[model samples]
Target: MEPQLLHGVADSVATVVIHHPAKRNAMTAGMWRALPPLLDVLAADPGVRALVLTGEGGTFCAGADISSLQGSPDEAQRLAQRAEEALAAFPKPTLAAVRGHCVGGGAQLAAACDLRFAEEGALFGVTPAKLGLVYPAAATRRLVTLVGPATAKYLLFSGELIDTPRALRTGLVDEVLPEGELGKRVAEFTRVLVSRSQLTQAAAKEFADGRTDRDAHWADQARGSGDPAEGVTAFLQRRGPRFTWTVPGPGSA
Candidate 1:
């Protein structure tokens, strides 16, 4: 079957699935181009609290479809990079629920997500070296930030596949689950994310991604949103905090 990017929302969590099982869900050029617009739609929807990126047929993505690599590769790589940047900058929480092979460009997409959860038997690799290609600078930097310079070098230089345990040990993956449990675990975690204050999560995501200078507006937002007051009152009243702070769409000040 032709490759496709399939998406749906349930319980406020949007799941984006890469579907191309015949090639282990390798991403086609069209799929790469389709991603940014889809993410924009989800990002602008206030009801979509989080996103989960996964692959169909028991595999995550194997990488860019090699058949499309025969000609000029610039446009394909550019589209892939654009999609990766969109996922990285998504205003709300995003998780990559990975299984099976996640290599090359597939690894890039997973690394772009805010969190990664992998099944026990999954494998990961950054294989630009094997293909005699240069990995994108932004993606390399993101990998370095997640696993540090040494591990990043190890993956980029050798182009070797690492299993789930080693991936988790190197901090490449946030969690490793049994084969059958990844979906349940990811769903549960996103539920926790959905119930939290959006203001807090968005600010924390920015800081964790290396924003050192505090925007004066974050402080003003905290006070004006009443989240702090509601949280404190709910704690004292022995009730769950009803947080209603919605993240403003991109470019809203």
Candidate 2:
């Protein structure tokens, strides 16, 4: 069967499953190609306030299917980069529900999300060094931004897969739950996110994303704009903040 990008919506959240269990949910070229548009639809849908990415079976994603890369490294690399771009550039809050092995491209995928939840015993690594492959620029930046340059370099250069606790210590995964509780934990987390204001979440994500960069435009926009004022006012007045500002188009910002 062809690899699938299964999608569904729950409450105000959409879930994207990378379903390729035979190979531990390793991503295929076609599946990678299909991602951005799938994400675009969710982003444009008013009902979707958040999105979750997970893998079929017990495994999250094992990165690219190396066997599929035989004579098409260039094509494979381009497709992978495009997929990473899609996840990284997605406007709404994105979460990666990780389990089992997350290596190479899979790590890249999880790192692209705004939040990452890994199950106990989950393992993470950037294996490009072992494969003698150069990590994609965008993916590399995401890793650096997540755990800082030193830790990122340590993972990338060593090609050593770290356990869930170590990964958590290094900020690789935000939350690590018991293996069996991944789905329930993710559901609870998603529900919490869905209940909150979409505008505040979006602004918070935007501000966090730009925190490492020198430009403070995002900070200025969030503080100087009327959104925070409205949020505070709503809080004091015992109402919800009506946030109307959305980060441009799906892939624009």
For candidate 1, the per-residue lDDT at 145 reads 94
Candidate 1 TM-score, true structure as reference: 0.97
RMSD of each: 1.2, 3.1
User: Which prediction has the highest lDDT against the true structure?
Assistant: 1
Which number leads on TM-score? 1
lDDT tens digits by residue: candidate 2, 71-100:
667778888888888888777889999989
List candidate 2 segments past 4 Å from native: 211-234, 237-253
Q: How displaced is residue 77 in candidate 1, in Å? A: 1.7
Q: Residue 207 error for model 1, in Å?
A: 1.0
